[model samples]
Structures are given as C-alpha cells and as structure tokens.
Target: MSLADSPIRHPDTASRPLMTRRGWWLVGMNILIPGSAQVLAGDRRLGRFGLGATLVLWVVLVAAIVTWFAAPTVIYTIASNSVALWVVALGLVFYGVLWLVLTLDTLRLVRLVRTQPSARVPIAALTVLVLVVASGGAAYGAYLATTASGFLSSVFAAGPSEPPVDGRYNILLLGADTGPDREGTRPDSMTVASIDAETGQAVLIGLPRNLEDIHFPSDSPMAAAYPNGYGTEQGCLVDVCLLNSIYTEVEQVTPELYPDAAARNSTPGIEAMRDAASGVTGLTIQYFVLIDMQGFEALIDALGGVEITVEERLPIGGDENLQNVDGWVEAGTQRMNGYTALWYARSRYSATDYDRMQRQRVLQEAILRQFTPANVLTKFQAVAEAGAETVRTDIPQSMLGYFVDLAGKTRQLPIQSVELTPETGIEPAYPDWDAVHALIQDAIATATAEPTPAESAAG
Candidate 1:
C-alpha cells in the first residue's frame, strides 16, 4: 500500500470535539457561577478554587449586611480604621484581577473547543465586555470607598469622644462665616441639635445670634478666662458678648486665654461656643460641626437647590452697615438656587435675626428632606465634594458610621424646634438662662416621647 493512502489522519484534530451551543452555555455559566465553566471543561482543580472564591465573596457580603443591621458601631469603627480601609481596598483590587482572569480563562476554553471563527469571535467579544464591565465596577467601588475614608479623616478628629449622655447626643451646629471684612470666622448661626441615640428624634434649640452674657462651663478654659461669663467685663464691644461673637473672640484669644483647647478641638472657637451653649442649655455638648458659610451655596447647589416657603420678600445681597440690597427673592412657595438660599438664611434687611433664624430652620429642614438616598446616588460625586469643602467637625471619624445610620433615621422622623426669640419670653440681651434651660428640656421631652395618634397620622 502506498504510504500516503495507508494512514492519512490527524490525531489531535480527530480527538478534539467541534464547538457547539454548549460552548456558549459554558461562557454564560462562567459569568453566573464563576467556576462551573472550568468544571465542565475538565479543569476540576481550577474550578474548585474559583468556586471557593465566589462562595467566600458571598459570605463576606452577607456578614457585612448582618453587621450593618446588628452592630453598626463595629462597621463604623472598621471604616474609620485606616488599616482596615487599606485592606478592603486591596481586597477589591485583588477580586477585580481574579474576575478578569477567570473571564479570560473562560474565553480561552471556548476558543479551545473547535468552532467556526464567526461564532468564536462574537463569544470572545461578549466575554471581554462582561469582564471589562465587572472589573470596572469593582474598581470604581473601591475608589469611592477610599475617597470617603480620606475625606472622613480630613474632616473628623482622630479619637472617639464620649458617647451620648442619658440617651441623647447634643451636638452644636455652627454656621461660621469667614469674610475678608471680618477679623475671623464667626458663628453667625448657632443651634444645638439634641438627638435621641436610639430613636433618632431630634430637637433643635436655636440660639439668637445676639444672645449676651453667655456663660461657659465652670471647668472649661473659657470659664477660666472670663469668670463672670462672656460679657462686657471681658472687653467685648457693646454686643460683642453676643453668642455669635464667641467664636471669633475665642479664636482670637485662644493662644493666650485657652492654650489647652487647641489640643482637644481643631477649632478652639467652636469649642468655646460649645461650652457656652452647654452652660446656657444645661446639656453636655458631645461634639460640634462647624459649617463654612462660604461653601454653603455650593453645597445647596450640589443638592440641586432646595424648595422653601418664603413668608415675606428676602433680599439677595446686602451689607448690614450699608443697608443696601442687590436683589430680592419674591415671597411664596418657590424653588431657590444656592445664592437665593444663602440670602434666605442670612438676610437681615427688614427682617430681624429672629426671622432669619426661623428661615434658617426651615431651610435646614428642607435640605434634610431633599438629601434622600436617590438624590445622593444621582449626584454622589458632587455631594461628596461639596460636603468635604463645607463641613468641619470635632466628631471622630470612627463614629461617623453611627451618625450616618442615625441621620437616616432622623430623616424619617419629625424635627422639633425651640427658638429663643422674644415671643418665647427670651430676650437676647438679658436671656433668662433658667427659663431657656426649661424650654430646651421641655422640647426634648416632647420630641422624644412616642408620637400621639394625631401626630402619627399627620406624619
């Protein structure tokens, strides 16, 4: 027999099976189950490893969810820990690499099975597309987490402070205005947000900016400097003893008056204000968040502006001394941009600070209502950037996770407020501290109590 006719055969080609619909099935399975493709392709060892990784990933996700609900503080502590954040970031990167590798491996197996080039090309393209999308999503998620961690570190303090006292955390919220004309940042708006730790109910106690003779805690440095309370005796101008001026005063004299305060709080001015607020309200100030009024407009704009009801016309721009107005915000229910909202909260042309305070409260509530999860997801980067620029606080980063949870709860609850205005029988110049304390206590009690049937129905 002739040699060519006797044994014309290709052993490798004969043994390999032709690619069919099963090849596509394997690719789909690999995407869904991560390792089943390898198992069916006869690589049992690799398949087991891949499947194990998938199982571990699911386990971690479940554990995280359970911890979020069962022990949120733990999650917060971990998030605040730099080491933990780094580890998580690296883990995400590793997972992304693994996902890409598995995807490529699946495509390789599909190509290994003999198939028409046309069919193989489409399958490979689809596999690569899935890999790119999945890996990109993981990388993006990691980036966001890392960015948040850095932002938290920048804005929050290092160590955790004392927890809520008697089931409530009393935080001083200060709106600090820093301008070239002003000597330093002054807390133009001051409010104490007393929050219930368990239920997230909150009572905002608004202090008139012109509140005078504000006292400091007996043991506080401010108290040591001004034994007779922050008043005219301290060489404050006629209205310099006002609550709003405390921040500027303390900041200017911190080095000489309260050298030790700088060690505890990043902003000594806010610390002084906190002590003053605590002394007057008879409540412990656990933490203070100072919002830079310069960034106020940006933050409002980031939230797509806020809807507010203007009882009367509001001036857009003006100088207190000049009594000049640049523009006016028409009255009625209307949507306001950042500039209009800032003026709505700060304007004092024909309106008194008392009126501004009411407007400020309404604006604050409106911002809270508008900052829903949907809004945040839609404009996450903008909101994050604006928040980082606008907010400064002595609250520890480790405790932010707890506060995040609390804020979500707070958004669902009705906010109660008590204003120290003339109608409330509290004069800014000679406020009755005793009465003020009583009012705050009463508001907290009423707010923390379970809502009445009528109130619940209305809510």
Candidate 2:
C-alpha cells in the first residue's frame, strides 16, 4: 500500500506536518529502534536491512564482551576495563550520527509522500532497511557498553578495606612462567610475602631456585640430615630446591601429559616440594598462587600495559630465546605487557638470579597498581576470567572474599621485600648440611621473634 493511497492520517495535524503525531513516531523509532520508525512511517526496505544488520552487530559485540570475562585475570580486567569508557563514548558519537542521518531521511520521506505518493511504499521499505541496519548496530553496541559498565559497577562498589587477621603473615606467590625450561611440575617464580597484619605493611622476600647447594629435603635418611643431605627441619633453604634438576625431571613428560607444561610443572606432586620448602625457610606458609603464562600475557594486554621501573637494563638475547620474540627493552621505569614482564622476571641467564628477584618485585607492584577502582571497573570481567584461566591459588573462593574485604578496609600499607640468595654468602653446596640447618633455624628465629620498639620505630 502507498502512503498517499492508504488513509492513515491524523486530523488537525496537517500544517507543520513533519511535527505531527505520525511524523514524531517516525523520529522516535529512529532514535529507539533505528529503522522501525521509518518502516512505520512507510519505509519497508530500510526496515528489513536495519533489523538484520543490528542482529549481526549485536552478536559480534556480545562475543567480545563475553571473552573478556570468560577467563578473567588482574591484567585482563585492568586492560579490558578501559573498553567500557571507549564503548560509551563511541556509542554517544554513533547516536549523534544516526540522529542527523535519520532527520534528513525523514525529510526525504515526507517529500516522497507529497510529490510521488505512488513511490512511498518502495521508498519507505528502502529507508526502513537503512534505519534498521544502523539502529541495530547502535543498539548492539549499546548492549556491549551496558554489560561492560555493569561489571565495573559491582567491582568498585566499595573502597579498599583491611584484612581479618591481626598479626604478621607470610604468603608465597608463585608465577610459573611455565615454558620450554623446567623440571618436574613446580613453580617458575616464587615470591614470599611477609604481611604485618597490625600495620598493614607488606614485605616480599624473593628467593632464587638456582643458587646451587642450599639445603632441601632429601628422600633418603642420610640426606635428610645435614651430614649426608641437607637434613633437619631448619636445615633446608631456597637453594635446596634445585631448579635445573627439577626442570630436567619434569621435561621428560610429553606435552600432552602436561598440556600447559610451564603452568603445571610446579604443580606435579607439589606437596613434597612445599613441605620441604616450608621446613627450609622456617616461615609458616599461608597461601600460594599459580598463574598461567599465556593467560597472564592476555591479561596484561587487556590492562593496556603495566608501568614498572627497570632496576637495570638488559638486552634481549638472540632467537635462541624462544620467548624473546618481543625483542629487547632498555632498563628504566616503563610500561610492560605480560610477555615482557614474564621475560624480565625469568631472565636468569642475562642477569643474576638476585636481579631477577628484583624484577619480580617490580612486577608485583605493577600488578597492585593495575587493580585500581578505575581500572577494575573498566576490565572487571575480562580480568576475572583471565585470572581464573591462568591462575590457581590455595586460597579458596570463600576465603578470597574475606581477603578482598580486609584489603579494602586497610589503607595503602607500606610494602617491603627480602631475598635469600647465594649472594648473601649462604652457599649450600660449600657449607656442611649442619651450617645450612643452622641458617634455616636462624631465619625462622628472626622471622618469628617480635620486633623491639626501637626496631619497629626505625621504619
């Protein structure tokens, strides 16, 4: 039916016809459903196209949104969170563009109805298609923006708080940059954190795995003691865990058995290693986190990039380093992605193990910075998904809420870290097992002993 042929008109609304009830309906739909307004105002073709186009665009936008949160991570959440802002801004721009376009098209429809009323049906259809497609795209884009927005709203609903515990606690954070090198299933990087519950102060103690001859738990009885092998509860130290030896044993397994060789390497029969490590360090272990390498990279990519200070400059080695595909970077405080940070933390050959420990600290700080409310709101789902995919932790989900609540309550607490490496003149290989045991005992004694007022005031 043609607009001029059919009789769907409003009485007493002829003059200034474009502002009439029917005309306004067309404009409103143009704003709300894109082509539907035009189709109602006699634009068939446009309506059909707009509807189809809208569906397609919606599918695409929703897919991106889902992927972001499906495997969330701190890095992904930080990076993807910014997308909400971009989505809202772009959506507004799109709305403006659509409004201008539809307004002009509305005028064209009016002219068609008056001049060639016979052409109304065809013109209306075509207009409908155009409006439908454009509006659909806009609507779908909006859905994405809305979904992303809601994510941020929930995560930043409150401010940072304090922890439940009220004393000093130590947690070992392991980032297994699981890759080509490693033995047995064990962590790639281990970070020991001493948190003062009373003061909300934190200390990260970095320990190297390759310091050769530190006391570790031995399977045999003789090795269990200091004389034959590093023995006694306090004899074992970080050096006792042989990285190369552990790596070699784990490498024998086919990739299938350990699909994520790097991620799972530190996981195979971790009980022995953990027990041994606990005995060696004398620090009561509380919690542990293991992060996936690739997922970790995706998260960093999502966060835009983490800013960190390069303690020292180190060149990227040749192609021999499979993971150095991103090439070398200079030493200085600069932005880094998951890949770069992973390399920096794992670059044992390029620099001393001690240096790597420092880099790990830098990465840890960067992680905390990336978790700001603004950042979390932008990438909540994505980061959450990434963390789930690439990371595993002994801290159960039930307890996690408590930790988060506690952290939120606490103000920005001071952060400190310590490292027990061979550089400290604690070579496990040269010294007798007895010496190593004594060292572990001494470390435990110092860690457990209450600090005097003078020492506490120094900081």
Candidate 3:
C-alpha cells in the first residue's frame, strides 16, 4: 500500500502500546535481506522487485569473479576500454540507487514515531549504518570506473593502428631528459621492443645514447642532410652530436627537416628519433613512447619503490667526474625511492655508460614486474595521474584493449635483451652500422623462432 499506511501497530505487541521489540525485528530483517520486512508484512510488490534486483546483481558479481579467475586478461581489456568502464559505472549507480530506495522504504515501514522513545536512537543509527555500507561501496566503485575512463581518454591518442611488419611490431621506447639547464630535448635512454604478433615472444634491443654516426632510412628527410651519417653536416663536437642529439638537432635547429611532422601530430624530434631507431634496428618502427624522465620519478614513487642489487658503490650525482659527489648508494640489495632509483639507473660518475645501460634495463624490467592486480586496483588513481604526466605516445587509444591483452600474454613469457656495447662489438666512435642492424635482426629472429618439442619439454 502507501508509505504513510505502514503497519506500525502489531497484533503481537498489542499488550504493550509503545513496545519497539517488533520494530527492531523488522528493521533487522530489512538490513539482512533488503525489503524482507515489506515482503512479510506490507507492500509485497515492492519487496519482490528489491529481491529480484539483489539476486541479479549477485549473479553478475559471481560471474565477474569467475571470469577474473578464468581469464584475467579479459578483465584488463575491459578495464582499459573507456566505453566498458562507463557502462560499468552506470550499472553500479543503477544498482546502488535501487538498494538505497529499498532501504529507505523499509525505514518508512518501521514508523519510528510509533516505536518506544528509548529504542529510536539505536534503530535510526543502525539503519543509517546499513545504508552507508550498501550504497557507499557502489558509489565508490562508480567513481573509480569514471576516473579510469577519463584517464584512458586523456592519456592515449585516437590515431589509427599500424600493421606489424614481417610478423613483428617494433615499438621505440625513449626516455627524454630535458630541463632548464639542458640545451634541448634529448632521449637519453633508447630501446626498441620487438614483439611477435602471433606469439607474445619479445626482445629488447638497447641503443646507447653515445652511438655515433647513426644512419637514417634511405627515403627519410634526414638521409639527404647527413649522407654519411648524423653529425656530418652539423659540425658539432663529438660529445654533442651523438645518437640522442638527433632529437634536439632536428626539433630546435632544423624544424624544417620533417615538413609534415606537425600534421602527423608529432614533432620533428620524435620522427627523427624513430627513423634513426629503425635504421639502427633494421625494423619498421610502428610506434613510439616518449617517457618524460623528470616526471617519471613520480610514477616510481607511486609504485612504492623499486628494489635492485648494486654490484658496487656509486655516487648519486656528480658532473662528469667524482669531484662533486652528492651521495653514495652502498653496494648490496636494497629498495630505493624514485630519486635514488633514478640515480641507480643512470649513475655514471665512476662507471661506464654501458654499465648504466645494463642497470637501466634491469630497472625497467623490475618496475614492470612490480605491477600486480591487487596493487593496481588499490592505487589506480595515483598510478593513472602519474602516468599521464610521464608518457607521450602515438599508440592509438582504440588499440589500448589489444595492447593490454598483449601485455598480459607478454608477462607470461620470457623477455630477451640484446645490448650494443663496447664489450659486445665495435667501437662507438667508428662503429659499423650494418653490424648493429644485423645483431638486432638476429635477436628478433631468435625471439620469434618456435621451440622444438624437446626444448619445449625441457622449458
């Protein structure tokens, strides 16, 4: 019937006109099984709707839990897609409002004015507590979903996808180090991640920032400028005109190098770096991810920290020599904050850049492996905010779902790395560009090769 016509008077409590014992029982029943009090007493139709909604929600929740167990990658895919997240948020708000309405209606059926004065406070408090527990959880979930959706939209682009070349998708990863003191943007750390399209097998090809005379593709805009190699036309110092300088040299000094770079929603620097990377790796670079190292420390901090073993003591900060040592990281296994980890991955005060390159690779893998499902869910907002500031890429947002799924598969497989260093081969000063490309191609070939039956069993 009507809310005003609630059955406040009970025949069982007729002996006591102002007794609240029956009121407590009905409210408790409503809290335990929403709308149960109405089902047993007043408004059976409303009670049925509440009960049906609860059952459907429980079923959906159970299915989602089961899917998480059976195929977690599916969950990641759904989580990354903005459309899916919006739908989930709407669903949560719908269920939350339904439950809230039922609970409030149940409170109306209690008819607090007819209950004993002494029991009124406790009954009201319990009802409010129940409302908060049931509705607040769903509200929080909806907020989280909306936050993730906005994050995905703001961070990734909507560009069209590029097909893989020769069974592999090569992504250029650049860590651009730029600041007030620095002359221009220079991607200090560069690597090419070549992943198999069908299988998730992958190899990381590390390119030293100091590699000299980096060649560009034949048809590249830069090919005509430095026919022999980079730095030939620039007339810059050996230390200044390294592989990483290609970015700054093009963007600041020679913006006219790539005429259509701006139209492509890219910078002359990034396009130049991509071409140089392709020439070095002998692979068609499909996309590029530029990580702002200055802001990237925040992401590492959000992830708590990274742990690594130090083979020797290294100074935290110094010029090119150890004359001005800021601090020292003692040798051993230790966990470090973002600032310390940055130094650990890049310290070259008393060591070689090759040493730093190796450390950087280890640090990269360690941070990636740190991502577990539990931590990601709990600290999602923090991670997303830090990521927005840390990454700029040409990878399409439409491909985020596919990339998330691919990441899951990649996590399950082994990752191999090939570093071009002094120990490995020719000198960086007078290097053989052809040899470096061959090494990268061989690494990709070995990474994509199918394992024999005997090898598979052994593995």
Candidate 4:
C-alpha cells in the first residue's frame, strides 16, 4: 500500500510534519479526556484502559460531589474509616501513575519537535504542568491520607464502643505533665466534659489539681489502699495526696494494678484517673483524652499561635516558689507563641491555682475556636503529627467518625462550666462530696435542658 493508504499509524510521517494547531488539539484532547488522543490516532489498547479508568474516576467524583451536598455525614463516616482511607490512597496512587504515563504517551504522539518550534516550548510546559497537577497532586493527597491513618492508629486505641450514660457522653480530659522537673507524668489539668448525646451541648467540670481526700470508686484498685479516700488521715504537712498526683502515684506505687491496660493499649495511670473522675463527678466517664501539656505548646504553635486576654501579668519560667521569674507576659490582649501560651496557662507565681485554672480555660477556648475547617486544612499535618506524639485516648479509632460528627455539633453550641473551687463551695483540702455531685448534676441538667423565655431573655 502507498503511504497515504498505509494500514499502520505513524507520527504524521516526518515528511508531512504537524501544524501548531494540530499538535495543540492533540494535547488538548489528552488533557480533556485523558486517552482520546490515543484512541483517535494511536494505541487503542492503552487508550481503552485509560479511558475506562478516567470514566470510573469521573463517576466517583460526581457521586461524591452529590453525596456531599445530600448527606455530608455519610462522607465524613467513610473518610474516618481507616480501611476506606487506605483504599482511597491506593486508588489515587494507581490512577495517578497511570494518568501520568498516559499523558506522557500523549505528548510523544503530539511530536512537539515536528510542530512549530515556538509551540513546542508552550506545549512541553503545559504537559509538564498537567503531570505535576495530576500525579504530584495525587501523591500529596495520598500522603495526607496515610498521615491521618497513622495519627488515628497512634492516638486512639481499638476497643469496644463505649456507650454514653444518662443521655450524655462524659469525656475525661487531662493535661498530662511530664518532664525532668516532675517526678513522673501527672494529669495536672483534669476536667470532665459532659456532652448531651443528641444536642451536643457541653458542661465542663473542672477539678482542682490540689483536690485532696479524693475518693476512688468503691471497687477501684486504689480504693483498697485508702478506703476513706486517696489521702492520709493526718492530711497535708504529713503524707498528703492531691488529685494531680494520683496518676504518677498509681503508676509508681502500683503499676501491677491494671495489667490488662497495656494489652488494650492503655496505661494504668489513665484507667485510674478515669475511675477517680467517675467517682468524683458521679458520672461515668465513657472516654478519656490525655494530652501531654508539653505537646500542647506545639499544637498551639501549629495554629500559628493563639490570642487570649490576660487580665493580669503572668510569670514565665520560675522555680518552686515561681519567684525568680525569667520574664512576664505583660497584661493586655496578646497573641502568644507556644512557650508564652504554656506559661499563661500555668503561671502560679503570685497567682492562686484558681486563677491559673481560669486562665487555662480561657486559653483552651481560644485555641479551640482557632480550629476552623479552613485553618485545619492548612495546618492539619502539623496538628495531627503533634497530637500523635502528645495525645492518648481510649476511644477507639473506629468511633472517630461519630466523634468527629459530634465535635462539629459541639462547636456550634455555647459551653458551660462548673469549677470545683472555693467560690463553688468546694475546698481543695476537704470538699463536700454530696454538694459536689449535686453541683455537677445541676450543671448538666441546665446545659441539656431547653431554656425558658425568661432564662433566654437574661442575655
């Protein structure tokens, strides 16, 4: 057969060459349909495969977009599942590499050098752009998914789902303090967030670090050691036991008490605190989120920093007395870095623990508000990495979908708090157990109950 009637396809034969417009159209087809260029003029086998993959991807994309608008929670549920995420990552990898190969083949068919020399540069540049966006973008996405999977695995344990109690999920939040200055890791900041299972309204119940004579659950391992409470008969100045010390005290004194905790990917110290928190609040703590206070600094830094109103001057670094202050975070509304924010939440120099606790709450609220979706999307990797290193929780990773949904709701509701301090008739040295339970219950009831006209108008 003559060249004009040749059965085999070749690159426009060197003699015929290609016009700039012809080459541009070929590249455009590949960019638009991924494999159309090949199917139209090149390899049908490879083109078919690429076309098939592209069709599936387009369908999935359209379905996902529709599902997001129709029922967003379903999307969230799927994204939270580790297995689903892995599948997504793998799919992106396979398709990304495949599309990249197809694009390069499309470029070869275009025969850039055969076109106007001027068009070759622009065409090559455009092809390079597509490769980066299609392949490089996919790689970045896979990295994020893998990062999330690792974070969930490291921070959240795999366990049976913990059901809420009394229409609420009481979560124990602890700021674990560990360093060379401290003997062992201590849950310095203890608060129980009692959340309405449906409404998502939350009531924060703060327990003072110095809370003494804290009674353990009747059946708790620590209960036998001190039947009356977790303290000595004589109290302070003798052999005193404070609430914050319970964690380290248990680990050091009775590490064997919770042997099963390790198997469940939990520590004895956390189990002990969960029991104590339950006993103290008279509410079952279904889950516990333990965050190392040191790592908390990094979390704040990841958000670029946080702004808090300081009504008083707070000392930075100091000793036992906190007298030799290295510097002071001057009074006024200020944006602080990790180190400064940490001190703002912990300064106990000339201030009482009550003041410090209040400051901690202030900082917590400020930081929590900073986690807007846009902000998180920008800084998620840093935040997730920091959390994996510093945060520990008993809540199963399987339940992440539910909790993530719950968190979205909670963010919309106003927060109420009850602090166990002198102002609330709670004495660190000797708190009235009956009164403490009553206050916590009342707080929860108020938080979950619908506000009346008069109560609503009080604003």
For each candidate in turn, the TM-score is 0.87, 0.51, 0.85, 0.90
Candidates in order have lDDT scores of 0.78, 0.53, 0.79, 0.80
Clashing pairs in 4: none
lDDT by residue for model 1 (337-394), tens: 8889988898887777788899889988888777765676577667679888898888
Ranking by lDDT: 4, 3, 1, 2
lDDT (Cα, tens digit) per residue for candidate 3, span 90-167: 988987897788778877767777677788788889988888988898899999999999888777766688888998
How does model 1 score by TM-score? 0.87
Distance from true location, Cα of 443 in model 1, Å: 1.1
Q: What is the lDDT of candidate 2?
A: 0.53
| Residue-level lDDT for 187 in candidate 2 | 59
Position 279, candidate 1: lDDT: 88
In the predicted model 1, the residue pairs found to clash are none
Alpha carbon lDDT at 439, candidate 3: 77
Segments in model 1 whose C-alpha atoms lie over 4 Å from true places: 1-20, 68-81, 112-121, 237-239, 319-327, 332-337, 372-380, 452-459
Best by TM-score: 4
